[model samples]
Target: MAHQLPETTSAPTLFTHSHPQGIDPSNPHELSASLYNEDLAPTTRKGRTWNSYSIFTLWANDVHSLGNYAFAIGLFALGMSGWQILAALGIGAILLFALLNLSGFMGEKTGVPFPVMSRIAFGINGAQIPALLRGAVAIAWFGIQTFLASQVLSVMVIALAPGAASLQQTSFLGLDTLGWICFVTLWALQLVIVSYGMEMIRKYEAFAGPVILVTFLALAIWMLFESGFNVSMTTGESRSGLDMWVGIFGAAALWVSIYGTFVLNFCDFTRGASSKKAIVRGNFFGIPLNMLFFGAIVVVLTGTQFSINGAVISSPSDVVEAIPNTLLLVLASGALLILTIAVNLMANFVAPTYALTNLFPKKLNFRTAALISGVIGLVILPWNLYNSPEIINYFLGGLGALLGPLFGIIMADYWIVRRARINVMDLYRTNPEGTYYFTRGVNFRAVAALVISSVVALLLAFVPALHVVGPFAWFLGSGAGAIVYLLMAKRRIDLADIDGEAIAVTPKH
Candidate 1:
């Protein structure tokens, strides 16, 4: 499965080519411009039809997850009117779409995973920074989703045998004994999926996403009907005008922050796409379209739950548990729990495994990397991270602050400064003359922009006066980093530095 280096000629740009006969399996580290082999090429194209549906499946898993619903309802609880909540949700979705579209274009252009494509802007070795950060986030999320999924298992277990609730009293690693068992069980299940690698993950998503979607849609309709047509739920109650607006903004910002890890690694999946056009089409359908539908579900479920319980419950698990006899409740909760775990495995667990393995390909392949990441995630004790609502919000917010700027710097370098072009062949070379190897495999400009912009964003998050601005942290950080990187890089490098004629075009999937 080793990738061959791209064939080079005197021509300044590298074009995609299939490897002749057998590929060298020994040197897995020796990657070329097109990080995919013929075996890895996508199978469908624009007119073929199925590719669009497959692409749509990505968001079904993303939106159907427990975390997605939890965050959306939490935003609704913020001090804003119904219109304001809808505005925040819409704005957040659009912004995420733009970010995904930009990142995905690189994948579509290069036909390479995120880590591979990042080599151009981050340098062959320098790409490790973003890779590691993204990997860490993924691992953390893997542990978290496992814990959340286990809670559903706990519910089912307790329902089956009421005595099992006693296990909750026995403490281990800050979680109850039953919680530990469930976490370990879900963790083991994820390993099984991760062992199969990317293709299986895709297939799992293709299946899980659609089933989960259909079930959730049915669940939402049932809840609305059961609760009656006049379920009254207000968005929020703000103390003052400014406070209300600020809180609403923060709520929206939180949604963007939740997808920080996904935003970074989306290219990993998109790289398999046949074209940039397909990538944009996928993002358009996936982000905004999915979010709109997902929000509808959240609002309906939120209102129905309030009417039934007299309090807003953000977690879908809590909402599901309230329904006494409904089969739909049991099915929807179980499906969501499974779907979230699947997402955790696909989105969070898989990225770090591949990214870390790419860092040390000589000694490690996919399995070793996954084992290391799983162990690291366990060491983090993700259940502890989820113990407090305030702590979880701050933790996610902190990560988002860093991610916003990192994305901005990378995108600015690739799109604005490089003008959507890269020396694909040169990306593999360690030689200083290669386009990516600037000053000992580091570009201080990108690094500086990331640090400065992240600091600004963090300040916005923690400062009391600036806390009101926290909801806009991602926008501020991303905008600042992109602007700074584009401005600074423009002064040092011109469009002429990139060969526009070198656009790589491979045969359609």
Candidate 2:
């Protein structure tokens, strides 16, 4: 049975459209009655919506994390100079911006979250596989980010009370007593925020983003004053021009790999966007311009590290630990901790919660799903995983490899195979006659393409013989998946039958 929507104000014009031929508004049996549930239904325009600024804040929260800071500084070790590194980051940012816009447009048009939007390409039941895969990766990241943030908090605690260092002597589950305290504290905080739902999450990021930017700027200024102006930007490595260029490209690929998962799941945030223009504008500012500024700050601050501390400092926490003033150390640590929490909530927590909810909408709502994700995050024991580079590489690299093919398949389905025309009602239907219910409610062609591409990419990433292409695995997989899916689905897809002007809506079931 379908529940009736409340008698509220009408939705905006962008969301209002005539029902498709097969969808009978008076007869719920012919509509997507099963999917009319709150978790899977299209968002009503009258509900809370995000503008360009909100969208910008989402990326701001994602990019301004301790891990991203470390990643930026680590690029210096790749044998590239200041300008070369900036250029690589800039190129990567542009590519990211373009990809985000494509994914965001899909969300805005459909007014549906990533997992729901995925049904268009993967079929109603088949979409759960990708959704669960993405959720598991996000859960792992949630644990990793939580562990990283707790380390910063532990530093702050030890700085405030020097005697607290004694807690480090007692260890359990690969973490000290103080470490467990901080980790559980941070974990509890994130769970509370997510429990309030997406609106609260949006407000939290909006406030945290500006404060984080300012704090980072302050850190950069402090470093500049201490190091003075005579800092070397060169790596002092004698490599040919071709080798340098290759290194620069490799750096760009690394940056792409870092955010590849977000690129695939961007529709999660963009689903709440007020309009397409707002999402596009937000992505442009949030990605390219924001990254350029961030990269410049990292380059300048890191270049002077040799003068300040006699060596380049890759981790931000290391720089904070070196500070002599306890007050300054506490302030910096708090800021870093807040930034980490913000990133973990947006990038790691929300996506998986929604994905899990999509998987079991009847049994689990947002809050329940979030709690489940949090428990799994702790169960992963991410501190152990973080300490081992081999494990981290295999885990994150494997996840990154899958994202590229997922992105490729979704994009090809939306733009090329379907020509941006979706049978929105059919997406939620279980009937065999429905357009999307291909072969037991699964598109095997897409499944095969994703599997084949991911396997090839993983081989390149893990196998020692093909290590040369490991860095660019994301690009290779995306290309391979796109080409393969297009070729396989060319005959089966009917662009003529699709209605381009149709918009998705939640019919009363």
Candidate 3:
């Protein structure tokens, strides 16, 4: 594997390598870097650039989650019509597309993961806070996603044996006996795959992504034909023009917030990208096109279910449960179960591993991070914690507040202030003059903005008077944080004038 060092005297970073002592001379592909050590970097490889289709596959993995399904159906209950929901979906996706483009550029340019990239804006030491925050969030979500995957597993098991359905009646620590077993099983399975590392995750995602697409299309077609194309169900939200716009914005903001955590770290994966061309191509196919197509199928199938069954069905398990033919039901449930697990591992599980590994590189390596997260998730029993949307709303909202400000401050610093230039060596130095170093390995300015903005948004989310903008909690927090940081930092730190040579930039963990 080839490694590119930061530029020297206007030359683009040149590929340079001298092996470290005390390590076996191993193949680049096989060598794993120290958790927090900056010396080990991703190897450059040929033909690793993902094309547009591959990007679409990534979205397929991201969008096919149980949480996504529930979100789609939840739109119907918002009091709008079908068309309004479609509009919201479309508009929201567009916003998300733009956001992905913005955040992804740094990744493509730097070829580093999110945590590493943070060294540019947050300083090497300051970067750890955001890394930990992002990683911690991923950890929580990893557990939640595992719980969701397990639900589908339980559904499949119970479907296979009607007698086993009785397990649902018995409760232990908020989950039933079957729930505990399935949760642990899925938890363990993810641990194994994630333990194998990113390569295995990529391979599993590539295949599972295509399979889920085919399955979803088939299910949509079957529903439309059976329920009739023109069938109508419940009246959705946003019937009026103004209301529709609100819903559209809300929907778009929701998509942005849902992905806000990853948006900060998208560079993590993109840093490994073969080139800037690959990163752009991937985002185009993955974020916009993929989300729209998936959203369309989701709406169609969910709508059909409502029209035919007189109730909205969201979870793929619910969709499978609706199948009349027992054989078909079994097959569909099994497929969905597999799909859920794949997405859970890729989107939810793998990310936290990277995040936690970054936080305690020497002590908690990637494997250790994954293990700790799994244990905590098992203890929380997120399955039981997520019994209702209110719970989901609370959890998601709290995260949204924190992530929004962190994202805002980072983006403002990087693109607007730094103008995209960085000193790779300075990133590692603890000198106060380093571009990222603030005071005490932490950026009090950014942290203060984050805390203040998050509190305001959180209040708006919970207070009745602010319910009108309840769904936009993330947008408010991020937007406010960015604006505040920009104004506050403008005079104190001229982001553009920082001498590129004076500030050494290091690779992220």
Give the number of the best model, judged by TM-score. 2
Q: Considering only N, C-alpha and C atoms within 3 Å, which residue pairs clash in candidate 2?
A: 2-509
* Candidate 2 per-residue lDDT over residues 1-509, each given as its tens digit: 12232232333222123346643445433434444445556665555368899988877767767778788777676566778878888888987888888888887776777887788888888888778878878888899989988888888888888899999999999999999999999999999999877777888889888888887788778778887765657556734588877877877887887787887888777767889899989888888988887887777678778665557777767777877899988988888887888888888898889888887766676788899999999988999988889877887767767888888888998888888876665666577767777889888989998998888778877899987777788888888888888988745653433321223333221
Each model's lDDT: 0.68, 0.77, 0.66
Distance (Å) between predicted and true CA of 179, model 2?
1.4
Residue ranges of candidate 3 with Cα displaced over 4 Å: 1-35, 38-51, 166-171, 233-238, 388-396, 431-433, 490-509
Q: TM-scores of the models, in the given order?
A: 0.84, 0.90, 0.84
Task: Order the numbered candidates by lDDT, best leading.
Answer: 2, 1, 3
For each of the candidates, the C-alpha root-mean-square deviation to the true structure, in angstroms, is 5.3, 4.1, 5.9
Query: Candidate 1 lDDT, tens digit per residue, 327-438?
Result: 6556766787669766887678878886776676545656667788888878888888777776566776576567878878888788777877665545555555557767
The clash count for each model shown is 1, 1, 20
Q: What is residue 328's positional error in candidate 3, in angstroms?
A: 2.1
Superior candidate under lDDT, 1 versus 3: 1
Our model 1 lands, by Cα RMSD against the true structure, at: 5.3
